[model samples]
Target: MKWNPQDIETFLQSKEYVDTAVLPLLPVAFDSEMGQAAGMSEFITLVTGQLERQFKGRLLLLPGFSYLKTCEEEKLFTDLLLWESQLKESGFSHIFYLTSDLFWKSAESRLDGSLIWIPSIPLETMQEAQKISVVESQVKQMLTLFTGKWHEKE
Candidate 1:
C-alpha cells in the first residue's frame, strides 16, 4: 500500500526533533530555463554525500519538494509521498528530514492515503547544532545497541 504526503505539521516522526542539518531544495522555476536551480540539486547530492558519511542507511528526504517560485507544498509533498512508498518497498522502516517552514499554516492536498502532517519539532523552534546532536546521539545509540545485540545473536 502507498501513502500520500501531508503538508500539515501532523504527519511527522513520533520522536521529538532538534534540526541539525539544512536540506537544500533547488528552485523548480529555472530548472528548465536558466540552469541555476540545478545547482541546488547538485548541492543536495553533495549533502547526500555528507549524510552518507554520517547517517548512511537511516536518511529520509523528500524527492522533489523544491519549487523555485511555486507555493505548492502539496505537490512537493506528493512527490515526497511517492518517494517514501518506493523507499519502503526497498526496506526503509523510518524516515526523517528537516523541514524549514511552519507547515500547519499552509494548505496541502487532502487526498486519501496522503502522508499526515506532523512534525516532531516545529521548524521555527529548532537550533542548528542542537538538531545535529539529537540525530547523531540517537543514531549512535541505535547502532551501538543493535551491534551488541547482533553479536549476542551470533
Candidate 2:
C-alpha cells in the first residue's frame, strides 16, 4: 500500500497481514552528479511503485528516504537504524530498503532488514511502452527476492 490517507486506513484495518514495509532510499545531489542522482531516484521510484502495486495489501510502501549523496556514512547508517527500530516497534516483521546506491551494501550486514540494490537504469530516453516493460521486468525479478525472504521466515 502507498503511504496515503486511503491506504493508511486500509492498512490500519488489516495491519496483521501487512507485515512488510518497503522504503526507497533516494539520493539528492545538486552538483555535477545531479543527473545521476535524479536517475537513481527515478528508477527506484518506478520500481517501488510497481512493486507496491503487485503486492498491494501485503506491504506498505513508505515515502522515499532521501539523503544527501555526500552525507557522512556513519550518520546515514544511524538514521536508517533508527527508522528500522521504529518500524519494528510498529509491528513490521520484514523491512526492505530499496536503493540503487552502492553505499548501503557495505552496511547491509548490520541492518535489521534486507537491502535490495539494483543498478539505476536511465529511463529518460525510453518510450512510455519501453519504460513500462523495463519496470515490469525489474518487478518480476524483485518478486522472487521478496517471496524468498518471506518463505525463509515461514
Candidate 3:
C-alpha cells in the first residue's frame, strides 16, 4: 500500500501480513531535460501504483529513493545496504528495489534486496491505452518476481 495516512493506519493494524516493502530507486539528474525526467517519474509511479494495488495487503510502498546527480556512488551504495538491513530488522523480510535505472542492473549483486529492473518508456509520448498496456505488462512481470521471492521460503 502507498505510504499515506490511511494506508499506514491499516498497515499498523495488519502488520503481520505485510512482510514485503517496495522501494523505488529513482535517479534525479538536474542536467537532464525536465520533461524527460518528469515522464520517467510518471511511468515509474504508474507501474508502482499498479503493483501496490495488486498486492495491497502484502506490500508497503515506500517513497521513491531520489538519487541526486551529485551524490557519490560509493556513498549511495553503502546507504542502500544500510537501509536494507534496517528494513529487515524492522520485520520486512522481502525488500524489493524497483527501478528503471540501468546502473542498478550491474550493481544488483552488491545490493541487499531484490532488484526489479525495467526499461524506461517515455510515458509523455504514449497514448492512454498504450500506457495502460505497458503498465499492466510491467506489473505482471513484477508479480512474477514477487511471487518467486514469496515462495522461496517454502
Candidate 4:
C-alpha cells in the first residue's frame, strides 16, 4: 500500500501482515542536460507503482527518496540508516529499496536494507504494448525476490 492516510489506518490495524517496506531510491540529476533524464525518473515511478500494486497487502510503499545525482552518495548513508531505524521501530522488519540507479547496489552492505537494482528500461519512448511487456517482466522478477525474502523469514 502507498503511504497515505487511508492505508495507514488499515496498516495500523493489521500491522502484523504488513512487515515489509518498499522504498524507491531515485536520483535526480539537475545538472544533466540529457533529454532522457526526465523520462527515466517517470519510468522509475511508474514501474515502482506497478510493483506496489502487485504487493499491496504485504508491502508499504514509502515516498521515494530523491537526491541530487551529482552529490556524494556516501553522505546519505547515515540518513538512510536512521530511516531504517525508524521503520524498524514502527514494526517493519523487512526494508527493501528498489532503484534503477546502480550506486545503491554497491553500497548495500553499508546500508541497513536490501537493495535491488533494476537496470533502466526506457519506458517513456516505448509503445503501450512494449511498456506493458517490460513492466510485467520486471514485476515477475521483483515478485520472486520479495517472496524469497518473505519465505526465508518463516
Candidate 5:
C-alpha cells in the first residue's frame, strides 16, 4: 500500500503539531508476505520524499532502519544496543518503535523469537486510520504527556 503520512490531512488538521511533526514512513506490505526488501526500498524513498515535501522546514524526516536474518543472539544484542545509541545520540531521546511479527497465519511469532527482547515497543498502527495516523497520534500523546508531567512536577 502507498504509505502517505502528510496526506492524512484529516488527522493532522485536528492537532496543532501539523507544522512541527516529523513523520518517519516505513511502507511494508502488511497484506501480502513480508521479507520483500526490494519493494520496501521504493516506498522508503517515496515516503522520504513525501516527508521532504510536507514537513521539510518545520519537521525532520529520520531514516528508517531495519535488520533481519541473525543466526546468533550476540549479533542481535550488539545491533540493538548500537542502533538505540545511534538514535539516542542523534537526539531521539524518546522513541515509540513498533516491533511486530505479522503473518505466519497466527501459527507462531516471526523472527524465530530470538530478537523478541530487542528493546522495541509494540504498536498497533494501520488499524484505525493509516499507519501514519498512528505515528501522528503517538507524537501528540507524547507531547501532551510531556507537558502535563512537566507542569505537574514543576
Candidate 6:
C-alpha cells in the first residue's frame, strides 16, 4: 500500500496482514552529480512502485528517504537506524530498504532489515513501452528476493 490517507486507513484495518514495509533510499546532489542523483531516484521510484503494486496487500510503500549524497556516513546510518526502530515499533515485521546506491551495501550487516541494491538504469532515453518493460523485468527479479526473505521467516 502506498503512503496516503486512504491506504493508511486500509492498512490500519488490515495491519496484521501487512507486516512488511518498503522504503526507497534516494540520494540528492546539487552539484555535477545532479544527473546521477536524479537517475537513481527515478529508477528506484519506478521499481518500488511496481514492487508495491505486486504485493499491495502485504506491504506498505513508504515515501523515499532522501539524503544528501555528501552527507556524513555515520549520520546517515544513524538516521536510517532510527527509521528501522520506528517501523518495528509500529508493527512491521519485515523492513526492506530499496536503493541503487552502492554505499548501503557496505553497511548492510549493521542494519536489522534487508537492503536491496539494484543498479540504476536510465529510463529517460527509453520509449514508454521500453520503460514499462524494463521496470517489469526488474520487479520480476525482485519478486524472488522478497519471497525468499518471507520464506526464511516462515
| Candidate with better TM-score, 2 vs 5 | 2
lDDT of 5 by residue, 63-134 (tens): 554544232545644654566566456544333222233321242232211111111122332353464554
The C-alpha stretches of model 4 lying farther than 4 A from their native spots are: 33-37
Q: 76, model 6: CA deviation in Å?
A: 0.3
Quote each prediction's TM-score.
0.35, 0.98, 0.92, 0.90, 0.33, 0.98
Predictions in order: lDDT? 0.39, 0.96, 0.85, 0.81, 0.38, 0.96
Candidate 4's residue-wise lDDT over 26-132, tens digit each?
77776653444555566677778898889888989999887767777667777788888999999888899888777777788986678988788877668999987
Clashing pairs in 2: none
Off by over 4 Å in 5: 1-35, 63-77, 94-154
Worst 10 residues of 4 by lDDT: 32-41
RMSD of 4: 1.7
TM-score winner, 1 or 5: 1
Candidate 2: list runs displaced more than 4 Å: none
Which ranges of candidate 6 are over 4 A from the true structure?
Answer: none
Ranking 1 against 3 by TM-score, winner: 3
lDDT of 2 by residue, 1-154 (tens): 9999999999999999999999999999999989999999999999999999999999999999999988999999899999999999999999999999888888899998999999999999999999999999999999999999999998
Off by over 4 Å in 3: 33-36
Kindly give the stretch of ten consecutive residues in candidate 2 with the minimal lDDT sum. 101-110
Per-residue alpha-carbon lDDT of model 1 for 75-122, expressed as tens digits?
766765675566456444443332223342253333212222222332
TM-score of 1: 0.35
Best by lDDT: 6
lDDT order, best first, reads: 6, 2, 3, 4, 1, 5
lDDT of 6: 0.96
Candidate 5: deviation at residue 148, Å? 14
Off by over 4 Å in 1: 1-25, 31-45, 57-68, 98-154
**Model 6 lDDT per residue over 90-152, tens place:** 998899999999989999999999999999999999999999999999999989899999999
